[model samples]
Target chain A: MLLSIKNLHASINGKEILKGIDLEVNYGEVHAIMGPNGTGKSTLAAVIAGRDLFEVTEGEVKYKDKDLLKVPVEERAREGIFLGFQYPVEIPGVSITNFLRTALNELRKYRGLDPMSAVEFLKLMEEKKKLVEIQSNLTNRSVNEGFSGGEKKKNEIFQMAMLDPVLAILDETDSGLDIDALRIVAKGVNHLRRKDNAFLIITHYQRLLEYIIPDYVHVLFEGKIVKSGGKELAIELEEKGYDWLKNT
Target chain B: MKEIKTDTKEIISKERMIGLFEKNREGLFMTDSEFMSRIRKDAMERFRELGFPTTKLEEWKNTDLKASLEKGYGYYLHPVIDVDVQKVFHCNIPHLDTAIIAQLNGWYVSKDVPLMELGNGMILGSLAEAFKEYPRIIEKYYGKYADFTSSGLTALNTAFAQDGIFIYVPDNVSSQKTIQMVNVIHHPESIFLQSRNLIILGKNSRISLVHCDDSYNQQASFANIVTEVFIGENASLDHYKLQNMNNDSTLISSVYFNLEQAANLESHFISFNGGLLRNNTRILFNGKGGTANVRGLYLMDRKQHIDNHVFVDHANPECTSSELFKGILDENASGVFNGHVLVRRNAQKTNAYQGNKNILLTDTARVNSKPFLEIYADDVKCSHGSATGQLDSEAMFYLRQRGISEENARMLLMYAFANEVISKISIEPLRLRIEDMVKKRLRGELSVCEHCVLHCNTPERPLEFDIDVTKI
Candidate 1:
């Protein structure tokens, strides 16, 4: 198993967000957590990514059988845990090339590998840029500064491709993207999928699941997983709506 | 009369300053013209009446200089020490070819002579020597733009200042090499020094000037320096002021600029480290169609304090002026940015803008920013804004999530913040050098060195960023 959570409990500022959550994932699996707004979907992703804002009152999160909560945010990232932000930050004066090179070099250092040369880094950036279908000269610009909704998402996936994390958790990556951008983003994700890697895609809608099929779907309502099923459960929920899950 | 307070004692008092001026009237303040002596005498009397500013004054409210003023300092009556120019100061800026002008303590020094006359009809030398060599030019422009009556420090500098840098550019001529004026204070004991500089740009002339103030050792010192610049019709001047002093030093520098018809000016002030620094910058649009852009950036940490007071007077019509100053204060450091723009009644079509931004790294780090515009012209456009806050938390998390350490993330944001002002540097080599210094400064690795700001600590080495972001 790549990731395992046993009765994970977390809260922010004394307001309990995730009351009790249990989940398990192995390599070569895609897990989609579908829920309504304000249902602790993002909070769960943030806690697993080592955000210090939330306090895990009880339970435990283990990555590769080690305590995941004890690791720092950057250490989690170096351990191949990536979280694509919902709203990508606009960092002025930090070019995309420079931001990625620093990130890649740090990750390489963690794994006891030599830092990539400028020529090699630029070459990898070019390859990743094509996978996301980013046509503009966005790599030379500041990170997400003045980028459109579609461009920011594409840049996130571009970063995902560069890092190649083992367990990728994307928070609402398909919310603001258009159809063409949605297809490009889904294409990038599908191309980067491997047997040894896993993904935890959190979304408010199931429209994105149609493009990149998830092996298992969990309906989270009121901070607990109410229903768990295969891909067919997504279509049933798409037709029946989430109101049924509230009563069940 | 304003009541002045002081605790740190055993230093020169106002009465002693008056006695020193009277005693050295014949020897130190010597000049051929009687008018010059009268100017010096009047300035001394003004200093006696105004005295040093205390916390009671509105302008000195945030910065209290009582401790700095109380330090016991050796005030010299003349340049009694000789320093070998080549041995004391070394220029190590790689590939930056500039004509160097050195000033030791408060007096100018040279290898051959005190003055140098270039082939393009430009003159560079000591201000005291210029009093006898170019008497008419000195009489026409010296002490004309500086406001000695209002600022007591300016009055004191004007009264005791004897030797500094002097530059003159003839009409229709421009300098081929950028002139770098460096003032190095290397005294064994604590000292109080005052230096005065006068620069004149004739009609249709252009010049680029880099003025640096550096302290060699960690000795406590107080420097009261004043500079007056005059730009003739259709002339342009590029000015840069770089200051890096010891933690126990106090520097109070005031520069007054007068621009004539269709003149242009761009001045940048970059201060790295100091105990207490106050930069009084004043710009006057004396003629029509003159434009001035004054910008500043200061990086301070520990218990350091920096204050910048800028006043722009749009006295003529069809003039434009803009002020943008940014600072990053860390630990218990404090900073102040007060920008005032005045547009007169007849100054129609005048446009003025002022903006000040700061980022305080800690809860104890503080900044007071005030942007004021007093406009009497109904047809003019003026705006002012000031903002002070911490770094964006979202950006911090985003960088951390990308596998960057928190330390490197903070450095990237700070370097980005300070780069807004440094990117405007027109000279490529100077801009690159400043970029390296600013990076080193953000990492707390830079200190008061024995050479110029352009002098890299390790020469002949390619600049590299720690986070592998150098190409950008």
Candidate 2:
């Protein structure tokens, strides 16, 4: 198993968010987590990313035989766990190139490898930009600063392509993207996928899965996995809508 | 205590004028005896009358000068050690063709500037020389920009103003490189150094001037610097003041900029060091069609106390001014920022914006920001705001969640906050130097961050890649 979370429970501000959640994903597998608003899909991504706001009361999250709970968010990132934020933060005066370089260097340090040279880094960025169709101007500008909804999503995917994480967690990556941007983003993700890589795609809409094509689909309700099945379940959920799953 | 009082009395009695001659009696260019005597007597009267502004004064309330004055500082004259003038020249940017002036202590040391080579009508020399060469310009513009009645310190500076660079650009002449003025204070003891500078940009003339102060010693020293800039009609002036003195030094600098009709003026005041520093910047849009952009960033740590007071007076119609000042205080440091924008009557259609933001890194560190806008004109758009808070906890958590260490994340955020001002600097080399200095200061190192391995990583990607990255 690439990622295994057993009976996970988390809370924030004295209120429970993730209640006894169990999930597993193998290498090369793509898991789509579909849930209604306030069902703790974002909380799960935040917890997995090691965001400090959510306190993990009871959980066991193992990534490649190592306990993921003990790792910090950046460390989790450096260890090849990527979390595409639902709402990317705008960091003014910090260029996209500088931010990506810093993140890449940290990952290199974690892997005991030297950082790529500026020449190599630029070449890699250029290649990745083409893959995600991100404008060169956006990379030169401040991180997520003045970027439109679709552009920010594209930038996130570009960052994922640059970092090349082993387990990619897309948290509502499809939220602000149009159909064209969605196709482009899904294409970028599909290009980045390999036998050694796994993806846990979280979304509120089943439209995103139509392009990314997850292997398994899980319906998350009230902070727990209420149902798990094959990819056909996503179609069923999309047809029936989230109300059916909430009642089920 | 008795000895201390006696020493303080002795220091005050001499004043800036008496101290200048006493310190530089053997200098070669001390021939203007009558001028010296008059300036000395006038300075003495002003110094005694003003008697160092106290906290009781409304302007000096946020910055108390009691501790700085109690130490009793003497004017720095002559280099204590041999300084390579060539090395200093080489350190400056080469593309700038403007005249360069170097001052050691309160006396002019290097007057062999290439001012004549500067095409068109431009004068860059010592204030004493300017007084002798161009008396009419000095009489009309000097002391007219800054109000001495409200500030005793201003009066004292004008009275004791001995050696300072005076740059005058004639109409329509644009300077190629910024005029670089290096003020090196090597005072190893508790000494008070006061210097005055005057810059006048003629109508339609464009110029840039950089004032940098670097100290060699760590002993207690106090620097009182007054810079007055006059921008004429349709002229443009870019002024940069870089203050990175020793930790034991106290710098109280006041810069007054007077803008005329259709003038464009941008001033950057960067305060990155000093023990107890207070900077007051006053800008007056005296003529219609004037625009001013003033920005400042200060980094304070340890017990350093930095206070900034900026006042923008929209005195004429159709004038605009924007001010943004940010500070990052860590350890037990304290920072104060008071920004005031005043739109006078008859100054209709005036546009002014003032903002002050501060970030405190530690629990004991404190920052007080007050931004005020008083407008008498009805048809004007004016806004002022002040925000004082710690680093964003959510941002910190977000970065930390991404596997970056907490310390690195904080550094990144702090760097971003300070870069907002640094990135606005138009001068490339100076901007890079300031960025390096900020990074070093953040990492608790006095040296440049680029050379430190702990703060900066060694280039793994060859020199070519490094150059490309630098270009980007």
The candidate scoring highest on lDDT is: 1
Error of 2 at B336 (Å): 1.6
Number of clashing pairs per prediction, in order: 1, 14
**Model 2, span A2-101: residue lDDT tens:** 8999999999998999999999999999999998999999999989888888899997999998999988777888878888888888887778898788
lDDT of 1 by residue, B125-150 (tens): 89888988888889899999998999
Query: What is the CAPRI rating of model 2's predicted complex?
Result: acceptable
lDDT string, candidate 1, A197-229, tens digits: 999998888899988899999988888888999
lDDT of 2 by residue, B1-472 (tens): 0111012222433354445545544442255455555554565566667767888887777777776666665443322323334433334333334445666565454424423325577777677677777778877777777676677777667655666667788888998866777676654356676788888888899987877765645667777888888999999988887777767777878889899999998888787777888888998888998999989988889888999898988889999899999999989999888888898999999999999999988999998788888889899998888888888887776565455678888889999999989899887766766687788778777531121111123322211111111111
Poorest 10 consecutive residues by lDDT, candidate 1 chain B: B463-472
Which lDDT value does model 1 have at B142? 92
The parts of candidate 1 lying over 4 Å away from their true place are B1-10, B30-32, B457-472
Task: Give the lDDT of residue B182 in candidate 1.
Answer: 89
- Where's the lowest-lDDT run of ten residues in candidate 2 chain B? B463-472
